[model samples]
Target: MKQYALLVLLTGLLSTTSQGQQALTREPPLVSPEIHDNHSVTFRLKAPTATTATMSGNWMRSEGFARPSATMQKGADGIWSYTTDVLSPEFYTYSFTVDGLRAIDPNNAHVIRDVANVSNALLIDGEFANLYKVNDVPHGSVSRRWYNSPGNTKRRRITIYTPSGYEMGKETYPVLYLMHGIGGDEEAWMGLGRASQILDNLIAQGKAKPMIVVMTNGNVSQDAAPGEGSDGYTKPSFMLPQTMDGKFEETFGDILTFVDNNYRTRKTKAGRAIAGLSMGGYHTAYISQNYPNTFDYMGLFSPALNNKPEDHPQSLAYQKLDLKLKKQMDNGYKLYWVAVGRDDVPILLAGIGDFRKKMDTIGMTYEFKETDGGHTWPNWRKYLTEFAQKIF
Candidate 1:
């Protein structure tokens, strides 16, 4: 499948198309089905050789098949067809498991990158999901903008999401500068994350304040220094933050700078916020420490740096928050929330426990939250929902 997803906002509801079967009846089964009209999907695979197949992921936690696997039928050209039930309008990940071998369908064009093996991942836009238009509130739109970097020429792309009321209303909202982890680009928030619609639902329900979110691709390459793009290529996750020889702080600074200048931003440090997931969470912690004046709130979700050795340079910075910075953080930081999943040990629960201790030693204040989900977007999304409700 093509990488780029078509953005659309549907306004009306269409009746179910099936005649003999109810909308709830067995769905058309295929490999990678794009969202067409309703919250339904049709998938097809040219697996003439395979007998049994299934699709699974976060949507229906595949706990020993809580989700019924769709049955496939052979077509004239040896294509197999199956359809997923009317799933909620959200992006999902599924692989077609054949007879007994765990493998992706060869005919599914949707593929996940960096996977050594094939992945039957597909993109289902909001229109296809049907939720994009359900609440009757206008949907938000995101724009990718470029700005001048202080000392570099390779331009970077920053994807900004503005709520429905942004342009039409006179109110100015706080800008949240969101960034993605090592391998993800600016699309991470909108694609798999569906930040726009999430924010739309929250704001419509008055659960979250209407605000603008800017997401940047945060992987910094050796050849691409601060204030520059890595030439549309991702540097290995290990090579970043030149000072650390590969940690991803310097490049993040440039991204923040660009965001500060290009948009009709609150522009002041108190009016700004920064956050991310995994690698992004690490960046949030690292940058908040160094650039004390740039953000009013800092949220770290499943932070990758959960457990760097106490002597690690990054840990050293947290330990020595400095009197002036510590006082400032104490005085103004609205919320400094750090969250981790109970099942996550990427840095391990003990790591964050240790990190909390270090913060306590330095008298640095923050909120630590725990959830049951592992290190995945569900946790990340829920973190956004909760942390956002607390932001100033």
Candidate 2:
């Protein structure tokens, strides 16, 4: 027994020594994204066996549904590196293509998913991008809560952002129902949109009011996002069922009920706001008009308001639009904000022009903002930032 115990002790010491040596000999982590003072960024990857390497990023112009890529040069030390020209201060996503295979920066853990693609996230902070950063301010609390959705016959996930000091105070705050695009889920606003950071910064700067921002999954067919639902780890698609068919707009009451019941919200039209991007903007329009008196402030960010097929059930929501708009206007609203990019898709531009003409014919007052850029996250973020400040 003594010999056995002695042998065990020797084995333990040998294992510890081996682990220590291994730890000491391990290669140091490479800094793939090295942001310089001049705002240029250096990206590096260690791929000695790779025949070719290239970096594709959202910063580059899109070439027929594909992002432009830059060639990366390899060094004698088995590391491929590329330095970008002085990039604009913004949040960008990038991926590396090595030997014909797409790859994310293995060294950078800051990754985000957009529809089916996953890429590494990089923030070049200076001007507007600074609003997307987590500044030293009283930060709000973001919670991922499941709410019972009777319309979908399942519990769905919703992300809520209660402003700072919400839990400690008994004061009731206004609510902003911020919806995501067709391809996005509840996590979209919190991740890509940087809603919390934008809100926190604006509130801290006294530029915007403190309110509860609720982000819901606009895809009513699915209860939750890809991995968060019962359907395990399925790949997300750009298009999903019942996205723009008015099903989500019909069932929006479930979300309102859940939020108002659980949170300290002012449940009045004057204290409620609804906004969204792309498909979400369509939802905002329908929900505001259908409900008539639920929300006072409405923001449409590059909305997809193209006319639907007359035979489709979705067209029911679009029918009698003038009557609905008249009723909504009669009901009284504080702000109806419509923002679109000057370079957005031609279809969207045509739709917006038609909608504006209709509004003009009916004498419905609204604030129209035309900005530079196409339908992208940068425009969406800018819209949110500007719209939040205007609302309660």
lDDT against the true structure, each candidate: 0.64, 0.91
Poorly placed runs, candidate 1 (over 4 Å): 1-46, 51-56, 59-91, 97-135, 151-153, 168-171, 222-247, 251-253, 307-328
lDDT tens digits, residues 1-392, model 1? 23232222121112323433575675455445655576577666666677676654455543321443545666776676666667664446666666766666565665653212335565454543433333677677788777554433455566889888678776677888776655565767775566787788777778777788988666533333222344444333433443222244545567667765655667777778888887788767777776777788998888777435234545334455455356656656777889888767544566667667767887877888888866666578767777777776
Clashes of each: 18, 0
The alpha-carbon deviation from the true structure for residue 58 of candidate 2, after best TM-score superposition, in angstroms, is: 1.8
- Tell me the tens digit of each residue's lDDT in model 2 across 233-338: 9899899988887778778999999999999999999899999999999889888988899999999999888744233555556577678989998888999999
Highest-scoring model, lDDT: 2
Model 2 lDDT-worst window of ten: 307-316
Q: CA lDDT of 72 in candidate 2?
A: 98
lDDT for residue 281 in candidate 1, whole number 0-100 = 82
TM-score of structure candidate 1: 0.68
Q: What lDDT does candidate 1 reach at residue 291? A: 75
lDDT of 1 at 290: 69
